[model samples]
Target: MHKQIIFNLPVKDLEKSKAFFTAVGFTFSQKFSNDQAAFMHIVGDDIRAMLMTETFFNSLINKPVVNAKEGNEVIICLSCESRAEVDSLIAKATAAGARIPHPPEDHGFMYDQGFEDLDGHLWNLVWAETGV
Candidate 1:
């Protein structure tokens, strides 16, 4: 069996988060979704992020939820096939309600852009130049 990674994130509204992710080109597995959370399938068997309601998350853990907006505890980085793919995802994410946290950065060998999801989770979309 192939190993997969699922990052669980707390959201204020499950439906809204679902809509946002869908608009940004992510498909969710309804089989894993319920009233409290939606499992978003990203990058086919490689990456996924679970959108869970605060109440549901609280029920699972005793620690307080980190306020992603106030401070980022983690930055999810996704590698892309090309620079255009990185740019396309950033534009799509922005149109889908994500806020661009920084201008696209070009590092000669790699290109990257940053955005904050509706719940303030940080995501870095990147592509590396093959010839570099």
Candidate 2:
């Protein structure tokens, strides 16, 4: 059985990608990171995101890399412990130059907020009221 999931994403600049995600509170795995790629460590899960440079990443795939800011591909959603955590991360993301596509939405049982990273990757921060 598969116990872990590692997602690979393309980035234009490795250093800038590192800084952006660092601001988002994710650490890097030095063992899997180098000049062309970075392994972003996601806490509480074995799912790590491999941030690879466009050229290096393209070599591994058959299709060309899309311009993220111009086209949407995927949105990475993270579960938060509370609304406060969601708000805090959103602030950090915006401060780190991420653009907020829309304001946060709150329902009786859930709250959702998100931002687009430097490379235009959309990340959603969500919180669900426990016991729901």
- Candidate 1 lDDT over 20-119, as tens digits, reads 8898889999899999999899999678998999999888899998888899889999989989999888889999999998899998799999889999
Q: List the lowest-lDDT window of 10 residues for candidate 2.
A: 39-48
Alpha-carbon local distance difference test for all models: 0.90, 0.90
Q: How far off is model 2, as Cα RMSD? A: 1.1
Clashes of 2: 0
- Candidate 2 structure quality by residue, lDDT tens digits, 17-122: 8998898789998988999999888864677899999999999999889988999878999889999999999998888899999999999699999999898888
Model 2 stretches astray by more than 4 angstroms: none
C-alpha TM-scores of all predictions = 0.94, 0.95
